[model samples]
Structure formats: structure tokens, C-alpha cells
Target: MRIPGPEPRADGGVGAVAAAGGLHRYQLWLHAEYGPVVRFQLPGAETAVSVADPVLLEATAHIDKRPERLFEFLAPLCEAGNLQVLPTAEHTPWRRLLLSVLAGRPSHERHFGQFAALATDLADRWAGQGDREPVALQKDLTTLSLRMIGAYALGGDAADPDKVVTAFEEVLTEHLGRLYQVPVPGTEEERARRAAQALAHLRATVDRVIAAHRSGGRTDRSDLIGALVEAGERPARIRDTVMITMLAAHHTTGVAVSWTLHLLGRHPEVAERVAGELDRVLGERPVPDYADLRRLPYLDMVVKEAMRLYPPGPYGARETTEALVLGDYEVPAGTVIFYPFWAVHMNPDHWPDPEKFVPERFLPEEVAKRPRLAYIPFGIGPRSCEGAGLAMVEAELVLAVLLKRFRFRPAPGHEVTPIERFVLWAADDIHMLVSPRVA
Candidate 1:
């Protein structure tokens, strides 16, 4: 059967996407009007097929290639290649190497102390802000995430953490702003120059870290650059890997924690449950250790539920290398397969009242009832984020720290609106009044 979607628009799909608020909302509209699978015009890819059914997604899960054009926006960030769209032959091994470091418990344990200190610092700063001033959760939390990831990827003393954070933000603001057509400060030429310079500084920072690894003769698996060097990765590739790792980890983790706070602020009862869990799990403690994470299941559930509602990276895309059948639809080779993650999470068939903020939905028993892909905030299949485990660790730790110390309420008169950027960002930023909790 031919897939269903809206009529082709004259301006390729940009106008429709804008009309629907953003791509996330547009996907929801398309799926609701059509069915689980819809054919639509995606600006860069031209014609693309979006699959919202979790079960249907399994057919395309093994396809390892990403559509190069769609992800070309990120090409400037890498020197070896755009890591996102690397060919399978090169990507498979690269992915395996990254997973070895990023997905391991040893690495997380080694970095836990640093991550906790960074999070606690942010909380302390927020504490000093006083309850009268609202904190910009997205801005502040994303900065915190950049610091954590910088420390994780480049090591504690390898680079100036503040400089790395500033450079990365400069580069990201320029590229993402251009892609979204959001007006960034400065002229086009000036913005491009600034982005190029920032990108160079970041690359040099990675190079310096790599040099330190080689000179120190340290080959610990827990160390990202060290592992890459030990694995015999070339300087360019190693630099690219660090750049990509930082790029991937930076905004996503911060937004995950920020969005969680945004949800918890609006849902005090749920927030109370999360706070209760934190208190019971880490009584008399200000922050959670690595061991304390697993024990705080309710907090984990709250983070998961919040991710389902406002996924950090709301959507992903893959390209078909061969003919594939998604349910009744047989898509030809080279087809663009869009994964509308938000739509899948909101699919009412699996999630009852999918819009509600109910952490119990993630209770072990409830999750077992749904398809595996039904709750994919990270993504699905081979090309899914290698940093999933670490992202969860970082997000949960930050949430545990903040939720344990304070109660967050939405700032009066401020609106929280979700807009699709590199990640799901609040259009005006999530402003919340954070007051300390009474012991």
C-alpha cells in the first residue's frame, strides 16, 4: 500500500513545519491524520517516510546508515568526517571503541566524583541566587552539562573547563542558529569567523589532551582520550571523536535534567514523590554517589517519564541501504526513514493517557507490557547514542542533587514552550523558583 501524508507543499515542507510549530508537532499531526507510517516532505531529504509504530521500527533498526544530507549541518564539527553519517565499515569499529569507554561502569565510577562536584557547584550557585530570582534552567543546566562532559571527555586538568565550555557554545550557537534560521548576534561573515575560530580552539584543546595522554603513557580504559590513543586512532580521528563526544553529551544531558525539573515543577505531587525517594535513599547527604543512583528507582522513573514527555533529541533519521518492509509498506533502497521519537512515546496504544506525568508508567511491570521501542528517548538500534548510559547517569545525578536540596516551582508569568533545536529547548528557557527544602 502507498504510505499516507499531507499533500506536497510548494515551499518544500518548511512552511508546513513552521505552521505546525515545529517538526515535533508536525510529526504528531501527520501521524494523527494518517496512520503510524506517513510519507512527507522533509526539507533536506526531499521525500521521507516516518514510522511511529514501535514494532514497525524494528524492521529498520538494523539499517546502520544515516541520511548524510539531513545531518550535514553537523559536518563542520568533525575533522575526520561527520561521525553521525560515517559509513558502516568505519563506523562499526569507531562505535565499538566509544562504547567501551562511555558505556562502562568503571568510567562512570571514576568520573562520578567530578560530576557530583560540578552538579553541587551549580546547586550552590543557584542556592545563592535566592528564591526571589528565577533560574534559567536550560542555560545554567546546559552549561553545567558542558562542564561535566568536558571533564569527562578531556580529563580534569587537560583543558580550561570554562574556555572549552565557552568555545563549544560559540560554535553550537552559530551552526544551530544557521540551521534553524534563528537570528544569532553579529553579521553572517562575523558569525562564521567566530564559529571557525571557536571550532579551531576546541580542536586544539582536544589535540593538547591527546598529546598529554601520549606523553604521560597512561592507557587507562576509564580515560576517553587515553583509550582512543591506545586503540591506535589517528590524531585527526581522536580529535574528531572527542569533539563528537562532547557535542553529543553536552546539550542532551543538560536538557534532560532541565526538562525533568520543568516537568517536576509543574507536577508537585510527582516532584514530592521524587523528593521523598531522594530523601529516603540519601538521607543527610546533599548528593548521590554512583551507588545511590540504582537505589533511587522512583527518581529514575521520574527522569524517564520526563524524557518521554520532552525528549532531549526529539527525532532521528536513518537511510535505507536495501529494500525494507515496514508493516504493509515496502520502502525502496535509499529511502529516508524518519524516527519520530516523540510520536512513538505518545502512542496511546502502549501508553495510557500518554500526555500525563505519571512516573508509575515506568514501573517495571508497566514497561514490560509495551514494545521495546515504545519508550526510546535515547533512540533505537545500531546507531543509537553510545552515551545513553552515561547520559542517564549524569541526568539522574543532577536531578538527585537539585531535587534533594530544593523544591522548584514555575516562575509566575513565565511561559515554558518547547521548540526543536539541536535538542528540545524551551523557546524562552525554563525559569523556575528554586527554594531550599526544610530538613
Candidate 2:
């Protein structure tokens, strides 16, 4: 049977996507008009099938490969190969190794102190800003996340955190700007040179860390670089792995926290509930310990709901290796299967009053009623983020600290808008009036 979608346009879906604001909104419109499975034109992929139903997603879950053309933008980040599009044979082991460290409790515990310190420092800075100054949640929080991941990925003392953050931002800004045609400051040649230099610096920094690991004969399971080196991954692959890990970790967690705060700012009652949970859990303590995280289930619920509303990475794509059946439709071999995560989270059948912000939707009994893929902020299947576990820990901790210390209200007269970028980003940054909370 034929999958439904909008009529083809000469601009190859660009006009439609832009007309609807961005790809995330475009996906929502497509699914609303065409049902769960829609075959549509995706600029690079030409014709793609998007599945917004969680039950339908199971069929595509095992399809491990991502469409290469869609991910070619990330190719320049790696010297070995773009980690996103690596062959399944190579990707399987890599995913296993990443999961071992990124998904491990010991790694998270080892990094908890550093992550808390970073979060506390950001809170301190925000506190110093005083209530009158509106904090740029996206800017400061993403920077804090970058620092946290830097400390985690490259040991706390391996490289200058500020330099690493600056260099990575330079590399990302240049590459993503070029891809989106965002009109960055310098001429094309200048931007390219800056990106190349930043990439070289980042690669060299990873090499230094690798050299130290080799010389010391370290094989720490909690250490990302050490684990990769101990696994006998070559220097280039190690560099690529670090680059990709940092890249993936940096923005997603930051924005998760920022968006949560953005939601809390607009919903003060929910913010108060989150604050009450933190107070009951930690008393007067400002930041949460690693163990304290599991105690604050409400904060976790809030973060999950926030991600459901504004997923950090709004959409994901996979390439089918064989023919498959999705509900009433049959997709051919080598088809581009789009996972509209944001839309899936908004599916009315699963999420009643899908537009409303209600943290209770994530209550244990409530969550048990929905399909597994319905709330996939991290994504689904084999290619899902290995950093999911870590990202959650980091986000919850940051939210715990910031909410425990401050009352965030929307900055007066400032409008917050969500636009699709490398991640779902606040186009103008989420500005909030952050004032200290009284005991």
C-alpha cells in the first residue's frame, strides 16, 4: 500500500520545511496531515519515509545504519570515518565500548564531583549576576555542559577546559554554519581556516591524552580515552571517538537543562514542585551528589517532559538494509526511514493533550502504559546515544543545582523561540530572570 504525504514541490521540500518554520514543525505538520507513516521529500535524501508512531518504530529499530548523505555534514569531524555512518561491522564494537564507559555507573560516579562543581560554578556566576540581569540559559548552560563533558572526556587536568570549549565551539560554529548557511562572521576562506585550526588543536589535544595513557599503561574503565586506548583503538579512531563523544554530549545535555528551565520559568508551580523535591531530598545543600539523583524522581520527570516538548535532537534517520512492513505500508530495501522523535512524543493517541506540559505523564504507572519508543529523547535501538545515561545524570544534577538555588522567571519582553539546528536550539537563547531562592 502507498504511504501518504504532501505533494512534491520543485524546491525539493526546502520551501515546505521553511514555510512551516523548521524541520521539527514540518514533521508535526506532515504527520498530522498524512498519518503515522508518510513518504516525503527530504532535501538530501530525496524521498524519505517518516514514522511517528512508536509501535511502528519497532520495525526500524534493528536497522543499524544511518543514511550517509544525511550525516555527511559530520564527516569532517573525524579522521578515521564519520562515527555516525560507520559500517555496522565496525559500529557494533564501537557502540559496545562506548556503552561500557558512557553507560557505566562507576564512570558517572567518578565524574560526579567534577560535574557538580561545574554546575555549582555556573550557579555562582548566575547568582553574581543579580536578579535584574537576565541569564542566557542556552549560552551559559551549554558552556557549562561543554566544560563538564570536557572534564569527563579529557580528564580534569589533561587540557585547558576553556581552550577545549572555545576550540570545539569554533569548529562546530564553522561547520554547522556552512551546512545551514547561517552567515557566520568571516569570509568562507577565513571561517574554513579557523575551523581547520580548531580541529587540529582539538585532535592534537586528544593525541596528548592518548600519549599519556600509553606511557602510563592506564586501562581505567571509567576513563573514555583510556578505555579506547586499552581497547587497541588507533589514535585516529580515539581522536574521532573523543570528538564525537564531546560533540554529542556538549549541546544535548546543556539544552536539556536550559529547556527544562525555560519550561519551569513559564510554569512556576511546576518549578516550585521541583524545588520542593530538591529541598526534601537535599535539605540545605545546594548541589546533588551522584546518589542524590535517584532520590529526585520529580526532577527526572520534569526533565523528561521537557525533552518530550523540545527534544534536543528533534529528528533522527536510519537506512533500511531490507524490505520492511510499517503498519499498512511496506518500505523497500535501502529506504530512508525518518524518526520524528518530537512528533512521536506528541502523538495524540499516546500523549493526550499533547501540547500541555504535565510532568506527571512520566509517573511510573503512566509511563508503563505507553509504547517504549513514545518518549525517545535519546532515541531508539542499536544506534541510540550511548551517552544517554550520562546525559541524564548531568542534566538532572544541573537542574537540581540551579532550581535549588534560583527562581527562574521569563525575562521580561524577551521571546523564546525553538529552531532546529545541530540540536533543537533556542533561536534567540532562552533568557530568564534568575533570583536566589529563600529557605
Q: What is the C-alpha local distance difference test score of each model?
A: 0.92, 0.92
**Candidate topping lDDT:** 2
Weakest ten-residue segment in model 1 by summed lDDT: 155-164
Off by over 4 Å in 2: none
lDDT for position 372 in model 1: 88
Query: After superposition, which runs of candidate 1 have C-alpha atoms over 4 Å from their true positions?
Result: none
Candidate 1 residues 402-421, lDDT tens each?
98899999999998889998
lDDT of 2 by residue, 243-272 (tens): 999989889999999999999999999999
Superposed by TM-score, candidate 1 places the C-alpha of residue 428 at a distance from the truth, in angstroms, of 0.4
RMSD of each: 1.0, 0.9
TM-scores, all models, native as reference:
0.98, 0.99
Error of 1 at 260 (Å): 0.9
